[model samples]
Target chain A: MKFLAEYRDPELAKQYLQEIKNTVTQPWSIMEVCGGQTHSLVKNGIIDMLPKEVTMIHGPGCPVCVTPLHLIDKAIHLALQENVILCSFGDMLRVPGSSKNLLEAKAEGGDVRILYSPLEAVQIAEANPSKEVVFFAVGFETTAPANALSVINAYRKGLKNYSILASHVLVPPAIECVMEDVDSHIDGFLAAGHVCTIMGNFEYYPLVEKYKVPIVVTGFEPLDVLQGILMVVRQLEAHKAEVENQYARIVKEEGNLEAQKMIFEVFEITDRLWRGMEIIPMSGYQVKEKYADFDATKKFKIEIEEAEENPECIAGEIMKGIKKPIECPEFGKKCKPTNPLGAPMVSSEGACAAYFHYSGLVEEY
Target chain B: MASKTKPVKMQLQCPMPKLDFDVITLGHGSGGVLTNKLLDSGVFDLLSNEVLDERHDGAFIEMNGKLAFSTDSFLVSPIFFPGGNIGELAVNGTVNDLAMCGAIPKYLSLSFIIEEGLKMTEFWEILTSIKFACEKAGVQVVTGDTKVVEKGKGDKIFINTSGIGTIHPKANINKNNIKIGDKIIVSGNIASHGMAIMSVREGLEFDSEIISDTTNLNTTIINLIEQFGANIHLLTDPTRGGVATVLKEIAMATEIGIDIFQKYLPIETQVDSACELLGLDPLYVANEGLFISFVEASIADDYLKYLQSDANGANAKLIGSVVNEHPKQVIMESAIGGKRVVSMLPGEQLPRIC
Candidate 1:
């Protein structure tokens, strides 16, 4: 409550909104590169309140929205197998795979459990010695430290039955890939605050310098988002492109050194494919060879076949900011939260789900 | 030929009760001595009244002309929660349902479907809670039934309550009466019941204990109807789907638009933090004791003041008002001046990694 109440203060938010309105001079498009920020913006109605000159484009910060279809299929395959207990975050339970989602598998008598943390999965493995326990590890850099520590803790305890289905993604490379697109009209960015809290703002300076884009590390609160937009607007108006910190209370320049070290010890950068988006170079982390025994893909001998996205879903274009969720013909009619045709419609932080859940405009579209 | 082997039995982990038979069995429902003992000593003794004491097949009672009849089943997991248990929930739930219909609940019929392996002490405890709740709500359990199933067939215990109440002649509380200018009033804090269950079920430890806001709303509702007759258009308890779902239901049912201001919504600090930590939205979290009222805008302030005078409605506030635009939709104006639709929850609220 200490941090939450102050950030949600209406008077303070009004001040930031006024500041953002006064700072903007011309039309500029900014992207919030975290699903949490996108959700806060939509839920709080900050998107509609912004100055008309500024456009807030949603980004690919939602890890659940970007997890490949094959990985979900593999997780479902492992979950339904005999003597295997599949532990995952609650968000992954409803995400549809190629054939079936994890919830369907669970209904069909799969031993699937929703865990708040990966460490709880390790504890489950310790308790059920006879059953193979696999944690569906997926998320951005903010989650890497915890997932990495789970493997480290398992190895330290010499737990043989524990492994993780790693789908860890990095934020910087994805930003770079977005910046490389010639059709993208992004002018600035609002970096995810929690990810910066873990990995620091050091990785973002290079992107800011190379792309000449102002990046403000922002928190997930109404006032924090308003202040973040104001900062980006000020930088854009002054023709300055630099990395600034709006969430200075939580994030630091160098990040958590110990967490970075632990992450390096457990995982290595590799080529990874985002669900609807094209494969970005060195955009994901794989369990290092030394921790191969803790890798679930190897431990379970999962053979993943190449899968294609639904031809009707425009989630790829939506993720790149080229199209909005409302622009898709099947948005609310065919693709909805209950029967999601794409990951964005299912994940809570996804742009499509955020728009569908919060904006009345979706009905008109 | 191989010899047939007897199946091994599983050892129950809980300590047995201090009774002749530690665990409940099918004999408890056989209408023999065990059934008589269970009724006379266990349930009837705790919840006794003149009608139930007559030992008749059904309760024969006199009621006023117009009556409201409603029934509900309680299948909440972990029958016991932080602030209350399923027994109190069952009573309050049915009582609130009747209250929502502008009726004063008077009599209730209680029934239970218990598992064979359940402990007698646990069953007694639940019965005691039901008695306490009925006494507080000024209702009597006039008739009831009990059945037992095999251990694997049921959970520990499940309760069903059917309530009958008298509706005030002047009260016309129905969704069809809602108009464009009607204002919406929420009773108190939201999302405590669902979060309390989640905290216990998921082993989520917070700095302070989050208890369920499970209490009877009949008295408060009756007071509102008595004071402001015909002005209150609709009364709905936001139970399963929280405030957002109830608002959507009203908007769609009446073909009216609802616009609620987020800043006026009352949510506890701890509930907000817990929801944030779990990636949950407080708007969609369930509340056991909260209800939303659609009243004429001219008298909405007076109604809010009247409600605020009551103990249960201390935190009552006017959250939103009906609108002509966006018919059949609910919109929320954010504190930062943004606007978005507050849609009904698609499924069970799950924690996200966003």
Candidate 2:
């Protein structure tokens, strides 16, 4: 509770809110590029408390929300195999694939287990020698180190029965994709703090220079987010675009070097198709050749197929900051958390779910 | 000489049967010697009362004019947790249910669905906890039944308890009685029982130990009912889906809106950290020992003071109030001065405190 309590201090949060109100001279739009930040903003009502000059857009920072439909299909297919034990983070259990979600597969006799860490999946593989255990390794750069280490640990132990269905995504490339979009009018960005904690703030400097947008690496607490907005507003008002660190306590300019080293050694950059957005160049990671034996897609011989996104879902536009969740016609009516039509509605960090969960007075906004 | 030594070694390894049987079998439910031995040595011996000792098929107890009957089944995994276990949970669950109805719980009927391979030592421990809980609640387990399922069919143990209590004549607690100006008072801290269970289940270790806030609320609830009577509009124990879900139910049932203030809601530091780590909202977490009461706004302050005087409701506070606006909705004024709807939980809460 050391860092948590300080960041949630009401008095401190008011100071930041007042600073942001004074800093903003004109209307500016900023996107928080992490689902965790999005949820915190909505749950704590930080979005509504911010000065009307600043509009907060939710980005596709949720790894579970951006995981492609085809990948979910492949995961479900692999989970249903007679001798396979599919392990995934709990959030992915309810994410609907084309035909069925992992939870449905579990109820239908698939050996699916919810694991907190990929290393736990490796342990399960060690315990159940006869069953092939595959972990659904999906997340942004924040989770890359842990997923990479699981494979490294498995190889060190010579765990042949263990593999991971990697859907690892990178934050920088996705940011570039958003900036490159012709219709995008984003003025600043709140970079995910945990992602910066792993990969460091060095990556955001290039994006700031390229897009001329102030990027503040932000934490997930209410005050952290308000303080982050203030930093962005100050930079924007002064007509200066630079990378700032509001979450300096946790994130450093040079992040965990050992973690970066481990990730690079096991993963290679590749073009990954986001669920709603177009494929961004080198926005995803694939298990390196040496670790191919530990990659579930290669081991299981899964055939990748092009799948169609539901036209009714505006998640792509929403992720790019072109549209808000409330703008979608199906937002609260046809689509909801219980019966999610898109990944954003299913993932806990997804912008749609956040809006839906905390949407009463928000309707007026 | 070797045979005699072998017998001695076997005796040393096996040890004495502190219980009649070392492990449970189907014969324990067959109404035979094994069944009698289990009851006589375990259940009846620990939970002995005049009514229970009578050994009748049904309990013939004397009750006043209005009686409240409620039953609940407990199947929480990792049966034993930091503050309590399935046995105490089973007893407290029904007792609280009856208390929510403004009844003073007096007698309970205990039943068990035990797995065949369960150890007698574990069963005895559970029985003992049940006895202690019954004594604390001032209720007696007058009659009971037991069934044995195969190893794979059941978890280690499951308990079902049905409680009967006398309802006070002045008590008129119901959702319909809730008025627009009613105040919502929550007893003690929220989200502790849920976070406690979740921490143990996920093997999460915090700086300080987080124990379940599972306790009997019969006495506290009865005392409040005696003092306030009809002024206490409604009472409910927030169990499966936390305070948010219970509030949603009340809103829908009465067609009134609920507005809760964020700063007033009492939450423990460790439970808050656990919830934050797991990306879970404390509002949606489960509670076992806590109850939320809707009381007349005029006497709400006095009622809160009375609740705070009791050890069980030491941290009690006025969390929210009933409103005519936003009918059938529960909203919270966030600490940051923003308002949002506190929706009911969608589905099962998954473990994610990684």
Candidate 3:
């Protein structure tokens, strides 16, 4: 609580809000490049407190939101197998696949477990020698090292029953995709602080240089987010497109090298399919050939034909900051958390879910 | 929720008595020698009172005034947790439900559906706690039944407690009674019980030890009714769906608006940290030992001060108030002066990938 309480201090947040109000001379659209940041902004009501000149755009930073549909079908298929035990993060259980979600499969008697760490899945494989354990490894760079380490831990223990169905994504490629969009009006970005804590601020420098947009590494706390927005506004006002770290306490320029090494050791960059979005080249991580024995897709010889997203869901547009969740035709009516039209509504960190959960009914209340 | 009490491991007052079997078997449910032996040895005597000692098929008791009856089944995995176990939880759950109805809990009927392989020692621990909890609430467990399921058919143990209580004479608790400008007062901290369970849950263990806040609130509720009377418009506990869901449900039902302040919401530092670590909202997390009261604005301060003096109400705070501005909506103003809707929980709050 030491570092956390201070970051949530209301007085400090007020100072940063005033600073942003004074720094901005004209209207600016700034996107926070993480679903966590978007969640904080909405949950803490920071979006309303910000000066009218600033508009916060949500990004496609939720791994659960962007995990391809076909992969979910495969994970479900694997879960239902006779000797397979599927383990996944709790959020992944609700995202609908082509037919049903993981929770539905579990209700139908599939042996599925919700675990907080991938290493626990490895331990499960160790405990049950006969049952095949497949971990639904999912997340961005913040989770890449841990997912990779699970495989490393499994291999060291010679766990023949352990494998990972990975859907790891990178933040930089997603940022570039947003910039390449013809209709995108994002002027600055508050990069994900936790992601930056792992991979560092070096990755954002090139994005700033290429798009001439100021990128501020932002923390998820209320005060940290407010400060991050102020920093971005200051850079935009001075016409300085550079990478700045507002969460300097946790993130460094080079990042955790050991974690980066662990990630590259077990995984390789691949052309991954993002849900509702087009395939971004070299944007996702796949298990390496050396870890092929620990890859569920390769081990089980499972093949899933490409599935399609719901035609009505504007998740692709929403992820690119082209449209808001409320702009979609079936936001709260047809697409609800109980019956989701897309992964964005199912995941807690999804832009659609965040907006649906935190944004009030009356706009001015 | 604030940490007014630490998790204390309860000690069994009486040791497990000698039994024919070390572990329960299917024969224990057959109502034969095994069943009688299991109960006669320790269960009946430990919870013995005039009503329970009668050994009748059902309890025959006398009631005077308007009564409240409530029943709840407990099926929490990890039957035992840091501060308490399923035994006390079952007792407190039904007791608090009756308390929320502005009733003084009096009699309880207990039942257990236990797995065949459950150890005798564990069952004794559970039964002992139930006896202690019943005594503390001044309620008697009159009649009961026990059934044993096959090993895989059930969890280690499941308890169901049904209670009947006499309504307080001065109480006027109803959702319709809530009026605009009514102040919302939270009894104590939030999210402690849920986090305590999560701390010991498989694969989600954290370094810090959080105790569950699972205690009876009948005494506090009865005292409030005795003092404030009808000024306390409504009384309800924020149990399963947490504070946010309960308030939202009330607002929607009564067609009244609620505005809560984040700064005033009472939560312990450790519980807040755990919620943040899991990417979970404490508002949606479950609480067992807390209640929300709707009182007239004039007596809100005095009510809070008086309630805060009680053991279970020390961490109590006036969180929000009823309004006519936005009917059917619950909005919370953040510590930083921003606002968002405190909506009903869509589903169980799940941990995030990050």
Candidate 4:
């Protein structure tokens, strides 16, 4: 109730909405990079609460939604490859890949499992020494620290059987991707609050200056989102692009140093493929070459082809916030939650999924 | 204005003895292994009637004609959410069960298990909600009872409601009619009610609000019965066990197999987001406002259309269908086109989700 009551502070939400309204000039589009933020914007009618000229578009903030279909297949392939236990969070189990997810792999006699944390993978590795245990590590910086801890724990314990199929995407590179969107035309960003809470707000300054887009680190609360939008609009109206924090109650400018230290200890910056977006430089985390023995893909020697988005899908444009899920011809017809033709439909916070679930027929205004 | 409600400590303090617990835990009532064990040992043995012995949330009997009966107790922790409350939940839950049998639900018996020392204002708001919900559902709480317990002995107000309705004479909806060609149709997205509760239960922050889709589905049931008649093979609302268990039950009961297309299932953004935060599977979560229709393939299109015509069924989708090949198994066709057997829950995934 403490959680619910605070966000529902009608008075606070109204105050934020008032501030946001005072900031917008002419028409402008701001994209919130985190799927969690996108969900909040749609669920609370935050968009409706905002100034009409200020359009908030969803960004590629969802890890599950952004995970490439081939990676899912690779995880499934490992699970089914005999004598392997594939572990992942519950969210990744139901996500549809090119042909199967972990759930299906489990059904096909694959040793697929759902674990609460990467530490559980270590536990399973310790408990079952004869068998190999692999965790499908997928998340942004917010989850990286805990996942990094798991690998470090496994290493400390000297558990040779434990490894990870890391699909960790980075926030800073993703923002840069938005900035470099050849045709995306994104003007600003409401940065995901939780990620900043762990990784800090410092990384976003370069993007703010390089792309000339206002970046505001905002919490997931309704009031937080409204206040964040207001901050971005104010920066845009004054042509003063900069990084600000509206969720300071939890997110600090420097973030959790301990978490950053732990994450850096285990992971190295690497190029990663986002499902519909191009592979960005140093946009992902991979187990450092020294920790390569704990990597699943390397352990299994998988040589699968890099996956391609369904050619019929306009998800690339959708992911850029230049278009909505419904804007794609394939969205409801050939692509949807039931049979997601792309990552956006599969991830819980994917823009396509949000648009499909809340307003199935599409919003007119 | 934002006001603090009493905090509910959901996570039990420090892990108790793995095999031992003081009170029934979430796992015990989770509809998983513990639930099965709880039922096998004595709970079901003591409370079951010949009809109730069917061991389902619902039952059908051939009284004079055909009759469907169901009872559910609402123990929602928060009691109130964005769209509705436990009072509305109780009414809608009962009505939906009766409608699941293609029954024109007419009467309900309400029973309240109240915890003493509860606030009068909360009681007033809840009762008013009951009146509003009953009126909207077009059903009356014809009989009722009230019981009070010691303050800490109970969890606020627990409500139990039983419903009775006459099945349409022309309607022959039953698992027996579930054939290979029958299609599986869901009324709306899965997990709205479950996530609506979880969003509040866990102190997770999101830039959004989750509203309960806690409404009666009698109208949708009524429309389906009117349009499809005998083509309607079966109908049931996947409440506590989510869509996964619902399909498994139908598969086991009918001695057939069911395939749910993962790509075709419905899920809301907020519900999905909340589920992600809590490590919950939306399919395994609960819902008070959804129903699954098992209609013959020939009429599946029409039934989907009929469902689509209604506001509640606007997000309705034709998932998988019934099949005699894989007997007693519920398999979901993953979005990637892989198939997995969706077995009945091994244990409760979440407690008090309803």
Candidate 5:
């Protein structure tokens, strides 16, 4: 509890809130480039406590929410096969694919399991030598190294039964997508601290310079988020655009070099489709040729046709900061956590879920 | 301030005696020689009492007044955990259910659906815990049944317990009794049981020694009712869906508003950290030994003082109150200073895909 309790201290959070209140001069829309940050802001009631001048826009940083529907369908397809056992992170099991989610598939006797790590899937393959084990590998850069390492470890152990259905997204392209959208009207950004901890803050420099937007690497804790907001507000007040690290305790300038090395060695950048957004170039990772045998899609010869999105879901606009979750017609009516129409409502870190679960009734208080 | 309470380690007295078989086979559940031998080995002697010694197919007991009957089934994997096992959980579950109805639990009927290949030693340990739990709750197991399934058809063991109790004389607990300005009090820390199970679960193992808060709440509730009488309007244990689900269900059922303050909710430090690490909301987690009581506003302070002095309710807190505004909703004022709607848990709280 050492790192957790200190950051959640109310007195310290109050100091940061006061500092942010005094630092801001005008209205500014600053986006947090991680769904985890959005969740923290909404869950801790930070969005309501912040100065009125600052508006925190949610980003498309939830890997589960952004994983393409077709890829999900493919994973489910593999799970339904007679001799395959599909494993995935817990959140992905609830996200809807085309007609059914992985949980639904599981209830229908599909062999679906929720695991914390991909390496565990590798071990499962080792234990059940006869059955093929497919791990639904999905995440941002923070998880890429581990996912990549699983494939490497599988190959080293000569685990032919082990393969990964990966759908990894990156943070920088998402920032660019948001900034490129002229309607987004963003001012600054709170970069995801955990992602930066893996890939480093170096990627944000060019974007900061180009967009003239301050990008502060932020942690998920309440104090870290408040301090990150205050740092961004100070920069916007002074018209300074630079990348700063508010979570320096865990994230360094260069990041974990060995993790990055493992990621690059096993995965190469590729064009990947975001669930509700257009395909951004070099925005995702795919298993390299050397590890292609460990890729589930390739191993199973899967080619799922692109599926259509729910027209009522405005997740793309919400992720781009062009619209708030409440702006959607089905905000909490047709779209709910129980019967979510989009992945945002299902994934724990999703912006829509953060809003729905923690939206404060300003009038009641 | 919420303080971390170490797990209470029960010193089990009786050891497993030597049996002819090391592992239970299909014949053990056949209701013949093997079944009789199995029961005679320990279950008969360990839980022996006047009512259970009758050994009839069903129990016939005398009741003077109104009685409450409740039943529950336990299917928790990893039956053995840090502080307790499924046996105690089964006993406490039925006992608490009956207690919530303002009843003093008396007779319980236990049943088991066990896998064919369970070890005899493990079953004896579970039976010992069950014996200990029944003694602590002041209840007797009058009748029971056992069945066995093949290895793949069942998780090690599943237990179902049903209990009958007499309603307390002064208690008039009802959801309709909930009124505006009523105070809501929790009888201990929250989320410890769920985190304890999560710590030892197969796939997502973390390096924490958190223990389950699985204990009987009958004694605590009976004492509170005896002292406070009709002042206690409602008593509910937050079991499957933590504090939020239980409160939300009450709010929706009675069309009353509930506003709880996050700071006033008591939780252990290690459990809080584990929840944070797993990206889980403690509100949506599960609890076993904790109960939330709705009492009259005037006696809230005195009730909390009395509860805090009890060993089982040492971490009791006045978390919130029934409100007139926002009817049919449960709202929580966060520790920092904002309020949000606390909804029923949609499904199991899954770990985040970060």
Candidate 6:
């Protein structure tokens, strides 16, 4: 409780909110790059408590939301295919592929199974020698290491039946892509502290200098978020760009070397599609060439086709901070959480899902 | 949707799991096939009773003419998540239970089992969260007690909250009232609060963000009851367990089967993806800020309109309804051309995910 209780202190939250209120002199938009932080901001009514001049928009930190339709389609296809055992965490099952989702396939007698970790899939493969078992690896840097380590263990044991359809994404490339866009609205960033705990905070220093905006790497706690916001706002108010870290207790400047190594060994940066946004350079990671034999897409010789974003979904625009999920005419109509039109609504990190699940009356916002 | 043409392989055989193990493993606690077995053989045997055997998260004790009593314990890892903390969770969880039973949750008693040396700051924050939670739900924490344990003896803090409320007499509601052709409606998207809790706790990131759908729904329920009145056959807040669990409960309560259209099942894109990645069934995952209502088909339209007219029910969808069959089962029509049995979660998919 000591580690966590302090972060929720109302007096502390009020003190930080007051300081943030006093610091902001002009209108500024600061994007919290982690979906978890976004949830806290909305659920705690933090945004409403803040000064009107400081606008906080959600960012593309949701890994599931950014995953492409084809990847989902591939997972369902793998799950439904005879003799194939598809494995993934709970989140991917409801994500709509082009035609169906893992949940749908599961309903139709597909061999789709939920796992607590990628390593569990390896154990399943080890236990069964006859069937090909594929772990549909998903998420950002925080989970990449675990997925990577699973691959390493599979290779170490020479498990022929084990492989992964890697769909890992990076945060820095995404930030850069946003800043490079000419019509961008992101003025600063609340860097994901958990991701940085594994991948380090140094990456943002370069972005701060390049974009001339504040970048605060902070934990997901409310106090952490509020403090991070205050730091970023002060930087913006002073017309100065800097990189700050409020999650110093857990997040070091260098990050976890062991995790980075595992990730590097298993995956290599490559082109990949994001649900709501266009494909950016080196934003996603593919299974390393050396580990291709353990790659589900490769081992199965599966042909993956990139499908266009759902025409009805403005998820990409929403993810880019250019549009809101409600902006789409079909938001609550044709496109809903039950029948999501795009990835943003499906992925946990998506802005639209955040709005749909946690937002209060659509009218006040 | 494009399909992936790959060298799909069969799932490795389950290694013919042993029928006997020394003690319960985490796998047994998982909401898979094995977990169901444990419930059938072990857990239910000890706890089963005429009333307590209902297998609900919290038991409902009707206090004759006025009061409704319910108690719940908090056991979420990382005690603090994206939205509300344990203190907030403790208050709303008990309050929501009273609301579910057609009662206006009005007062709460808080008890805390804390680890020793717990930071004063953190404890203060928890109290603040409870204070705000009370304010939001329009409930009062009349009194409370706190106890501390040695370090490593506890998971930071565990909250036990008991609440009481007054039920509305004119608005009698029960799942048994559901009949064939009754319409099923969800208050909003599912899995947001559940997935958000998992992602933040597990350090999993998505293309979007996840926030806990933690809120007081007494007002929303009251709104529906006012508009639809007795037409609301059943009302349940699917927390700790998702929609699937509640549906199964209703099926048993009504002695009739249920069939929900998968397409009409409301959930966010990210929550869906998060469920998939975690190898969890969103139907079985926990939800903090969502509900499902079963109403007579004749009044379904009016209720639907009333739900949409309100902000909380803005994303409400007409999912499915009751069928003529034994009430012990739940059946969902797949988006694909097939029907599948949707049952109770049996075990916890994500431990301490509440």
Best by DockQ: 3
Candidate 1: stretches off by over 4 Å = A303-305, A362-365, B1-18, B26-37, B54-58, B203-207
All candidates: DockQ: 0.45, 0.35, 0.52, 0.04, 0.44, 0.03
Index of the highest-TM-score prediction: 3
Best by lDDT: 3
lDDT (C-alpha) at residue A55 in model 3: 95
Candidate 3 residue-wise lDDT, B1-354, digit = tens: 001122335566568887778899998998999999988988899999898899988888999999999999999767888889899999999999999999999999999999898988788888988988988988899989999999878888999999999999999899999999999999999999999988877767776767889999999999999999999999999889899889988988888999999999999999999998887889988899899999999999999999999999999999999998988899999877889898866677888887
**Native-to-model Cα distance after best TM-score fit, residue B340 in candidate 6, in Å:** 34
> Compared with the true structure, what per-residue lDDT tens digits does model 6 show for residues B57-168?
4454444576778999997665666666777888888988888888888767677777654554455556667766777788866544455566656677889999988886
Kindly give the stretch of ten consecutive residues in candidate 2 chain A with the minimal lDDT sum.
A356-365
> Candidate 5: misplaced stretches above 4 Å?
A360-365, B1-13
Question: iRMSD (Å) of candidate 1?
Answer: 5.2
**Considering TM-score, where higher is better, how would the candidates rank from best to worst?**
3, 5, 1, 2, 4, 6
lDDT of 1 at B198: 78
Model 2: lDDT of residue A31: 94
Those runs of model 2 whose alpha carbons end farther than 4 Å from true positions after fitting are: A303-307, A361-365, B1-20, B30-37, B54-56, B202-208, B351-354
Candidate 4 accuracy as TM-score: 0.59
Which ten residues in a row are the worst by lDDT in model 1 chain B? B1-10
Window of ten residues with lowest summed lDDT in model 5 chain B: B1-10
Q: How good is chain A of candidate 4, measured by TM-score?
A: 0.95
Which tens-of-lDDT digit does each residue in B1-354 have in candidate 1?
Answer: 011111112232233334676677888878899988778664776788999988799999999779999999998766777788888999999999999999999999999998898877667667778888999999999999989887767777899999999997768998888998899999999899988877766423344478899999999998899899999999999999888888987887778899999889998888888888888889889999999999999999999999999988999999999999999889888766678888887788888865
Chain B TM-score of predicted candidate 5 relative to the true chain B: 0.96
Residue-level lDDT of model 4, residues B20-96, one tens digit each, is 22234345434588646534543333223455455445454444567888998999877766677788899899998
lDDT of 2 by residue, B52-141 (tens): 999988887888788999999998766777788888899999999999999989999999999898878678778878888998999999
Interface RMSD of 6: 16.4
lDDT values of the candidates?
0.87, 0.86, 0.90, 0.74, 0.88, 0.74
Q: Docking quality tier of candidate 5?
A: acceptable
Please tell me the interface RMSD, in Å, for model 3. Answer: 4.9
Clashing pairs in 3: B1-B189, B1-B190, B1-B266, B1-B267, B1-B268
Q: Report, to 2 decimal places, the DockQ of model 1.
A: 0.45
